[model samples]
Each structure stands twice: as C-alpha cells, then as structure tokens.
Target: MELKKSTQKRHQLLNAALDVFCLYGFTGASLDDIAKRSDMHKSNIFYYFSNKEALYIEVLTSVLQKWLESMQMLNVDEDPEEMLTKYIESKLEFSRLNPKASKLFALEIIQGAPYIQTILKGSIKKHFRGKVKVIAQWQTQGKIAADISPELFIMNLWSITQSYADFETQFEVLIGKTLRNRSFYQTAMKNNLQLLLHGALVK
Candidate 1:
C-alpha cells in the first residue's frame, strides 16, 4: 500500500502541475498554486521535485512527449500530401483536446524559456531539424514545392495552424465564433494545407 500511495501521489502531482503551469506559466505560477490544485502540500511537491522550475520542466516534458507521440502515429512517407494533411489534423486535434498544454508551451516559448531554453535549442532543435530535413527531401524529390524554403514554409505553416490554439480567445472574440466550428475555417485549413502541397511544389 505504501507503493500504491506513492504512485498515486506522483500522478496527483503531475496532474496538478499541468494545471498550474498551463494557467499561470512557469514564472507566474507558484508552488502554492500547484499544491492547491493538486490537493497536496507544498512540501510534498518538494518531496517529488526539487523546485518549482524542476516541476515545470517535468510538465513541459510531458506535454512535449505527447506532441511527439502524435507525430509518431502517422507514417511520414508514401503520400506527402496525405501524410502532411493527417499531421496537421493531428496537431489541431491535440490543440482541441489539450488546450492547456498548448497554452503552456506557447507561454514558455513566448517568454524565451529561461529555464528550458537549452533543452529547446538542443534536443528540440534536433527534433525539428530532423522533420525539416524530411520536408527538404520531399521538396528535392518534387513531392513539395521546389521554390519554398523548407524552414520558412514550415514556420509559416505552423504559425497559421497553431493560431487557432494559441490565439483562440482573441480570434473568437473578434470573429464572434470559434475557429473550430466554422466551415469557412475548415475549408481555409484544407486550402492552406493544399496550398503548400499543390502549386507551391509542382505544375
């Protein structure tokens, strides 16, 4: 029963950490907030993690792992268009299903990630470069537009797609409806996805 209690406590801490970090950001959030959210004591948080920064990193790592897992679910070959289409869908789906994680990630990145900058520039860089290289390979093989720079194209694509998740509140307030529920928005997504795959790459 001791081990069971330990496991439960660990899970509880993780869940609480996610909520606090997502809502308050790493710097904005306090250990008190995590403890209250998790229904555990601040001292207990220390028992599991050395500091708030460490716990925040763990939460970010967990969120990153889930995003990477989503990427791993699809084959990145055979049909570049379909492959990329599904990939975008997966990312959007994750945003809808895991908005808090998205917000946390966006917040960390927006602040320059003082605590996690090294990890972002290191392992995360390698991971992103790997994917970018794949897109470059596709461009070289005529699978994507030969004219578009893989890096710029990807940056734009991500910016456009993640806009819904990152700026939904503002976007919705302006449009008076959610981007997720609109047909025009859906078609726009389909069109933009195709725009990258269509003439941008070939005749």
Candidate 2:
C-alpha cells in the first residue's frame, strides 16, 4: 500500500510538473510553481525528483517512449499509402491527446535542447533514420513513388504537422478557427496531407 501510494504521488507530481513546465518552460519554471500546481508539498516533490532537471527528464522520457510506441505501430507491411496515412493520423492524434507534452517537446527543440541534445542526437536520430530507410526501401521496391527523397519527404511531413502544435496561434489566425474544440480541422489536415502526397507519389 505504501509503495502504491508513493508511485501514485510521483505520477501526480510528474503530470502537474509537465503542465507547469510547458507553460513557463525550463528556465522559467521553479519547484514552488510545480508544487503549487501539483497540490503537493515541495518536500514531497523532491522526494520523487531530486531537482527540476530530473523531473523534466522523466516527463520527456515518458512522452518520448509513448511517441515511440506510436511510431513502432507504423506497420511496414501495410500498403504504403495506408501506412503513410496512418502515420499522419497518429501524429495528429498524439498532438491532440498530449498537447502539453507536445508543447514541451517543441519548446525544448526550439531552445536547442540544452539538456536533451544527446537524446536527439542518439536514439531519436537513429530511429528517425531507420524510418527513412524503410521509406527508401518502400520506394525502391515501388511501394511508394521513386522520385522523392525519403528524408526530405519526412522532413516536410514533420514540419507541416509539428508546425500546427508549435505555432497553434499562427494556425488559428491563418485558418480563423481553433482546432482544439473542433473536429473539422482533422479532415482539413487529412486533405492537406493528401494534396502534398499527391505531388510526391508516382501515380
């Protein structure tokens, strides 16, 4: 019972910390702010996480692992178009479901990832390249179109969708509506992705 309670408290603190960090960012956030947001004592917060960096890293690693699970389910055996569509849909879904996590990730990358640069350089980069290699193989085997560069294709796709989360204000202004309370934006996303894919696909 004690172990369960301890685990639950740590999870609660981490969740609250994620939100506070997303709003104020790494340099802007403090333990007191996180403790207040979490409704937990400052000492209790420290019990689970020694410092801000430890908590931030845990939140990041948790989100990164979830994102990676989503990536792993990409299903290479499916038809390339369906596979690509699923990948895009999942990306949008991740943004929708974990906006704070997404926001913090965006902020970290935007600020040059002072703390987690190694993650971006190592595991993330390796997995990303592996996906690109899969795309390249698909193209070589005529699964996807042969003309486009797999790496550039992924770069474009990531930019377009990540752009939505990273610059939500810009998206809202340009589209004249918020997608958060709206479902129509999803179809728009699908259509825009299709249009881009049309140019890249051989057919």
Candidate 3:
C-alpha cells in the first residue's frame, strides 16, 4: 500500500512536470513550478529525482518511450499492409491522446536535444534501425514498393503522424475540429493510411 502511494505520487510529479515542461522548455521550466503544479513542496521533487536536470531527462525519456511504443507493432512477420495500417492508426491515436507530450518532445528536438542526445544515439537509434530493417525486409519480399527508401519512409511516417500533435492549433483552426472528434479522427486515420500505404504498398 505504501509503495503504491509512493509510485502514484511519483507519477503525479512526472505528469505535472510534463505540463510545465511543455509550457516552458527544459531551461525555462523550474522545480518550483513543477511542485506547484503537482501540489507538492519544492523539496519533494528531490525525493524522486536527484536534480532538475535529472527530472527533466526522466520526463523526456517517458515521453519518448510512449511514442516508441506506438510503433513497436511494426515487424517483418506481419502482412506489410496490415502492420502499416495498425502502425498508422496507433500513431494517430497517440497524437490525439498525448498531444502535449508529442509537442514537448518536438520542442526538445528543435532545441538540439541536449539532454537526451546520448539516448537518441544509442537505444533510440537501435530501435529505429530495427524498424527500418523490417521495412526493408518487406520491400525485399515484394511486400512494398521496391523503390521506396526504408529510412525515408520511416522518417516521413514520423513527420506526418507527429504533425497532428505538434501542430494541433493549426489543425484545429484549419479543420474546425480537433483530432478528438471521432469523425475527424476516422477521416485522419483513413487518409493517412491511404496516403502512406497507397504509395508504399505493392499494388
């Protein structure tokens, strides 16, 4: 029971920190703001994280993990079209559900990813390459277009799906409704699947 409470409190702190960091980038965010957001004392943050930088990194890592998990369904064994369709749907759903985290991650990347560069170059890179390898395998198997570049395909997928989150305001303004709207979300999912699969899949 005590451990559950402790874990809950830690998650609360991380959630509050995510909101604060999204509003103000890493350097701009302060522990006091996070504490206030979490309704905890400033010193309490130290119990979970060693310092501000540590807390910031933790928040960023959590966001990245969630984003990566959405793409983990991609694999060589699955039907290419089915796997890609599910992957696109999952990415869109994540964008709708975690827009702030997505935007925060984009902000960090735009700022050169100073804090998470090592993780990006290591585990993230390895994971990304594994997905790329899956796409390449699909291409080699005549599952997708032979001319498509696996790395560029993956990069384009990220750009399209994440744009819905990173540019939520623009999307809402232009579409007159957010991705939260069921009809709009379905439209988005269908359109994205068409745009991506139509170009890559073998007809």
Candidate 4:
C-alpha cells in the first residue's frame, strides 16, 4: 500500500527526469528542470535521486535495459530468419514508442557514453558479445551469409533501426511526412527487413 505508492511516485520522477534529459542532454539538464517537469518540489526530487547524475543514469539504464531485453529475444533456438524478423520488428516498435529514449541513448553514445561507460564496458559488452557468438553459430550452420562479419552485421542492424528514431526530425523533413503517428514506419521497417534477410540468406 504505502510502499506501492512510494514506488509509483519514484517511477514518475524517473520518467520526468528522462524527458528533461532527452530534451537538454546530460550536462544541460538540471534537477530544477526535472522537479518542474515532475510537478514536485526540488527536495522531493532529491528524496528520490541523490543527485541529477544519479537520476540521469537511472533513466538511461531503464531505456538501455529495455533494449537489451529486446535483443535477448533473439534466442539461438529460433530459426535465424524468423528471429531476425522479430528482432527488427521489436526494435522498430520500440523506436516508435520511445523515440525520446532512443535519442537520449544516441546522445550518450555520441558524447562517448561518459556516465554509462562502466555499464557499456561490463554488462552491455558481455551481452552483445554473447549475441555476436549466437550469430556466428548461425553463420556456421549456414543460417546467414558465411562471409558476413558478425560484428559488422550487428552494427549495421543497430544503425538502421536506431536512425529511424534518432533522426526522426530529419527523416520527416526529407520524406515530407511524420512517422510518429503513421503505420508507414512499420511498413518501411518490414520492407527493409525483407531486403536485409534476402541479402543475408544463402541462395
């Protein structure tokens, strides 16, 4: 009862922090901004997070953890084609639903991931290596192109999927339309996914 309410309020604060951080980046965003956005006193914000950096890290990790979970969905037991299709679909959906999170993550990476470097070097790197191994296994089994480099394959996939989210404004301007509200985004991803699959599979 009491604990549940407290947890909910803390989650709310974290979400508010995410919005502020995404808009202003880590160095630009302040706890005062987060407090204003959350409609809470500055002291209340501090009660939830010891400092602005701590709040930003939590928000970033929350988004990154969701991404890692999506990646983990690509189990080795699944058919490579089906797994890849699902992975692209999931990433596209995540971008659509959480564009701000995507942009925030891109900002962090572009800035060299200063705050999250430890996590990136540790758990995130370990998890990514595991997935790369899975892809290597698939390649050996002739599930994908034998000549493809697993690292490059994953990097390309990340770039393609994340671009739709991180570059939404530029894309909308170029395409003369907004994907934020349209089913066209999903359609586009599916078409691209098919092209990738065709290229990766052995004839």
| TM per candidate | 0.84, 0.90, 0.97, 0.95
What TM-score does structure 1 among the candidates reach?
0.84
Q: lDDT of model 1 at residue 102? A: 76
Question: How well is each residue in 1-203 modelled by candidate 4, as lDDT tens digits?
Answer: 99998898888898888899999999999888888888888999777778888888999999989989989877778898888888988887888888899999999999999999999999899989999998998888888898988888888888888888899998888986545757777677867697667788775
lDDT of 2 by residue, 1-203 (tens): 99998888888898998988999998899999899988888988778877889899889989887767766644556577777777777777677667788889989988989878888889888878888888887888787778888888887877676666777777678876554855756775767578657876666
Clashing pairs in 2: none
The candidates, ranked best first by lDDT, are 3, 4, 2, 1
Residues 24-107, candidate 3: write the lDDT tens digits. 998899999999999999999999999999999998899888768867899899998988888888888888999989999999
Candidate 4 overall Cα lDDT vs. reference? 0.86
Kindly report which residue stretches of model 2 are placed more than 4 angstroms away from their true locations once superposed. none
Q: Give per-model CA RMSD.
A: 2.7, 1.8, 1.0, 1.2
For all candidates, what are the clash counts? 3, 0, 0, 0
What residue runs in model 4 are displaced by over 4 Å at the alpha carbon? Answer: none
Task: List the lowest-lDDT window of 10 residues for candidate 4.
Answer: 177-186
**Residue 178 alpha-carbon offset, candidate 4, angstroms:** 3.4
- Candidate 4 at 169: error in angstroms? 0.4
Q: On residues 133-165, what C-alpha lDDT tens digit does candidate 1 reach at each position?
A: 878888777777777787787667666666677
Regions of model 3 farther than 4 Å from truth: none
Which candidate would rank higher by lDDT, 2 or 4? 4
Cα lDDT listed for each candidate: 0.76, 0.79, 0.91, 0.86
